[model samples]
Structures are given as structure tokens and as C-alpha cells.
Target: MQPEGQAKRLVIVSDAWHPQVNGVVRTLTKLREQMEARGFEVTIISPADYRSAPCPTYPEIRLALTHPLAIRARIEALQPAYVHIATEGPLGIMARRACLKNNWRFTTSFHTRFPEYLRERLPVPLSWSYSFLRRFHNAAEHCLVPTQSIHDELAERGFATLKVWTRGVDRELFRPQPDVDLKLPRPVFLCVGRVAPEKNLESFLSLDLPGTKLIVGDGPDLHELRRKYPNTVFAGKKEGETLARYYAGSDVFVFPSRTDTFGLVLLEAIACGLPVAGYPVPGPKDVVGASGAGVLSDNLQKAALGALEMGRVDPDVRLKGFSWEACADIFESVLTTIGSAKVLKSRKVKSDRVIPAP
Candidate 1:
């Protein structure tokens, strides 16, 4: 229990934030809003607040170039009841180091499958990457995963202290709008994610499905993909009502990524009364779950066509299991477990390992 009128402070250190429209950003934004509504004071430290450089290949993602000492100073000043490291980028690394130096127990979230992502673009072995990631996350009191399948997979890969931290969708904004006129062919199949190789966009692009194929996001592979698949409609990035309208206009939401920890877009698509089409992968497998909101198969082309005829499930009944409020409840529980009576007492720190000022 906390003292009256004194809000419990929670500091979130993430490498991903605004100007970058991705699942991680959306999830954190909603989580912050919901947590604040639940009486927790949330502070976010991200690339948006620091000097940053464009990430290689993925220039849309900005990497924080600030020094570890600067991050240490910021976190120390906050003196948050709990600290959460949300990504494996520079900011997260620095925050982890700061916690170690101060002997502070913090939690981390494994949002991306960096091992598979690196292997797609680099020559490094997956084992090497997983080894590094394991060391990074093992330092935390808890390593939050988005799905049970991912938790099981990481556990097999030697990740410890794993906990399931699911994601949610904004139903009010994403619910179906049968009146929106897309003017495209009937039974349109839509893919709404970064147009990158790791996303396996080519799999969806090369499919022999009927009607028009539309892509609703942009990325490094956009130009090349548009050139290769000239027939596909590239609608660039969308948000709020525009994004929701697109989701409603489409007949099926196609997700091609096999490495995603959880496809937040899946919930959004289903919430818009659109069935999903994807492989029997972790994200879709965990989300669809025989909800009759999606058709998952090894043959994406077949699945796409199958999803076209599938009747739209009532978004309310289908999406009842997901909500930002519920997601935030779990997050606050973790913060309370680490920040409350369990280990809230200050511990003696080693004076020799002091973090220097930048």
C-alpha cells in the first residue's frame, strides 16, 4: 500500500517513442495513459527527449546517442518507485547499467525477437545474439514477454524470470465502420505493417489471391517492394481515424511476420470487424486462438481467400478479452510487486561503483 495522495512513481526507459509509429510505441503510449488513470505517476525517458541518430537501414527509428551518465542522472533524479526498461537499444542498455550501479531492481520487456531480426540483416549467428540478450535481460527482476508462446520459446533459449505481459487495442477507435468507402475491389486483403524483409511482405505480395492487395504502412523496403509488386496499393502510414477506416474497409488483415512477439495490429484488425489471415505463427496463434476472427494456415494465399468469405464477428464479443485497462492492471501489479512491501526498502549501495556525471 502507498501513502495517501502520494502517487507511486513509475519510470519507463524505452528506445522507441513518438515520430516512430510502431507497435511498441502504441503499446507504451496506451499503457502510460491507463496507468496514470489508475493513480500511478508515469515518467517516460525515450529518444524523443535526447540527442538521437537515425538507426541503420531502418532510418525511421531514431537511436538515442546520449551518454550512460546522462541517463543515470535522469533516473536518479526521478527516484521512481519502479523502473522498467522497455527495449534492447542504447537507452535500455544505459538504464540497465544505471540500475546495476545503484543496486536497483528493475524489470525489462522483450518486445522484439532481436536474434531473428539480426540474422535477417547481419551475418551473426542467432546463438550469439540470444546469448547477449539473455545476459541483458537476466539482470532484471522480471523479463516481461507479450505471449505465452514467446515466453516458452525464450525459456527454451535460456531466458529467466519470464512473465506474460499481453497487449490491448483501443476498441472505440478501431471498431468497424461498414460505411467507409475504400473504392477498391471487393474482398480486399490488407497488410498493415512496416514494408521490410523481416515482415515477409514478399510472401503476401507474391500471393495469387483475388481482389486488390493493399499495404497501409511504409518502411525501408517500400520503394523496392512497390517496384516489384506494382499491382499492390501502398497507402503509406496512417493513424487514428484514417488507420481505423482502412482496417474497416479491408475484408481481411494479412500479417506475414513470423518473428513478431505479438501482433498488436491483429487486435486492431479484429476490433475493426475484419478477420485475419496469417501463418500459424506465435503472434497470430496466440491472438486468434480459435476465436473465429482469423484463418491461420501455412498457405497464406489460401488463408486470404478463406478469410474473404468468413463472416465478421461482432467486434465487442470478439475483442472483449483485450483492453488497455486490463493490460495496465497487469503492468501495475508488476510495479507493485517490485516497488511495494516486497523490496521497497533502500539497500546499501557499493560507493565504489558510482555512476559519473556526464
Candidate 2:
């Protein structure tokens, strides 16, 4: 530590990025832009790209999973002031443990409700998994959450030092153009995100209603799912203008994930003026309750049917109070605070490293 005023370097480690088509990747990418603009030197450490929903529009970032001892040596050579571990995977665990032993502070993000997601797919009860998750996150000095609801939920379950830095939607890309109608038949139902079993997408496909199902993403389950449900139009992964058009064209957006800590995609659907219809769970619960954004239910079929009866809501209602600019601004503040603290901490560490044991 060379005095409190020295500049600090920030490194972020996560298992999700680039190829992963989810909220954390989007948030971290935007946050990187914001942090760099604020004069912080940023480094990202992530695993090699893996299979995600494969959004065609956005280019993937360059990443490496675990570079041997040589890669670790290279990272240490850079001398990062703080390592911010954002996921609980092999790479992230290594980063966190290394930082902890060396007296360096690290922060983490709670994005996915992994316990619930894994439980829905596997055999373990959520309670046992939650305790395991709590242990993993408790290692961090500060763990970030995207909503007050998630924060409260985690806190109640014994997670500590929770913080909030919400996800943002790109308003420019997802602007509401009510003048341009999709011209689909009345009561069109749209479902975005992965077409996998975990997404609980089968319910949306079986919505026994009047309109066509506009399925706008792809996953491993796409082939069988498309074949099983001829009612759905498989539009694969789309982005930018294409995605906005898909959202704009639909009358209702159907999301079926209860395991999302914050459904950034839910906000994206709302941003395009498409009223949402999904289960009354975590992601939808937060977005809908906060913005009165869309119709929701415990049953997807019920929600879809209820949406048809909902008629039309003012588009401006759901579109209000959301923007990517605002999300980036909040992220800037968090990085600034962390950067300042890291500088002071580095100085103390340096001072201690120099002094001999008394």
C-alpha cells in the first residue's frame, strides 16, 4: 500500500459473459463501459464461451476459461487492486480464494436464483441448496442484487451485506413505436428467451388460445419443441432492430422463468410496450409489481387467457421509469465507491508488507 491516494485497478471475474444470453452479461458489459469512462482500469476474467441461446445480432466477447499457472502469473503481474468475483463457478471460486488469502477485498453479484433453477431441473429441495449458496456468497465483503425484493428475500434467508444495483434496458434499441403494429392476428402471444425445459416454455406453447405463438429465441430444446408445438413460429435468437421488432409486433410477452433474480429480459419486453403474461414469480413479480407492467399468474395458461381479456393498456404506463442510461449511471457510482475504498486498502496492505514482525 503506497498511501491512500494511489490509483486502484479493478478486475472482474465471472463464468457468464459474451456467449451467455442473459442479464448479468448485459449488465457487466454496460458496467464496463461506464467504469472505463470513470477513469478506472478494468479487467475481465471469464471462462471460454459456452452454449447459450446464441443471440445472432450481438458479437461475442473474447474469453478464456482457465489459463494454467502461466495465466495466473500474468494476472498477478498486472497487480490488480481488487478482484470482483461475480459468479460462483470454478474460475470465480479460484479468484475469490486467491484474493481472500492475500488480504484483497472482493465483491460479488447475485444474479440467478441458481438454487431454484437447479432444483426445478434436479432432485434437491431448494432449502438445502439455498444454504449452500449462502455459504458461497457469504465469502464476499459485499454481494450485489438487482432489486429490493431479491435483497429482502436473500436477507431473510441469512445472506449478508447485500447491495443493490439494478439492471437497465437499452431504450434506444427497445423504443416503443405504437404507430407501427406487427399486424399479427388479434391476441398474438410472444415468448422470448431459451426454448428449454428449464424456461418452463411448454406452458406458453400449450396456451390453447386464438392467436399464434411468436417464439423468438433458440436453445438445445428448439428442435423438439418446435416439432412438438406446431403453433409456435421459431424465430431463433434475434437482437437490436430484429428483437425490437419481435417485441413490437407481439400483443403479449410471455416469460416463464421463476429462477431469475432480476429478469432483464422482462424489462426489455415491457420497454417495447408489450404487456407481459407469465407466472407470478420472482422476476415477473418484481417487474410487474413495481411498474404495473403486465398481467401475471401462477399458471401460464391462466395468464395467457387473462391477457386476452385484458384488452389494451396505455403503452406509456409500462415504458415509464426505465432506461439503460440510468442503469449505467448507478453502476458508475458503485464502481467509484469501490475504487476509492480499494485504493486506501492497498496502501495499508503495502505498509504492512514492508514492516517486519515486532
TM-score of each: 0.93, 0.83
Taking the tens digit of each residue's C-alpha lDDT, what string does model 1 give over 1-358? Answer: 3432233778999999997898899999999999888778889999999888999988979999888999998988876767999999999999999888877888999999888888999999999999999999998888889989999999999999998888899888998898988999877899999888789999899999888999999889989988989999999989999999999988889998899989999999999998889999888988887356888999998888778778676777777657787788777777632333222344422442322122
What residue runs in model 2 are displaced by over 4 Å at the alpha carbon? 1-8, 49-74, 179-183, 308-321, 329-358
Model 2 scores worst on lDDT over the 10 consecutive residues at 49-58
lDDT of 2 by residue, 42-136 (tens): 88877653232322222342334454453445456666655677887666667766665455666787887777667666789889988977987
Error of 1 at 336 (Å): 5.2
What do the candidate models score in CA lDDT, each in turn? Answer: 0.85, 0.70
Per-candidate count of clashing residue pairs (backbone under 3 Å): 0, 5
Top candidate on TM-score is: 1
Clashing pairs in 1: none
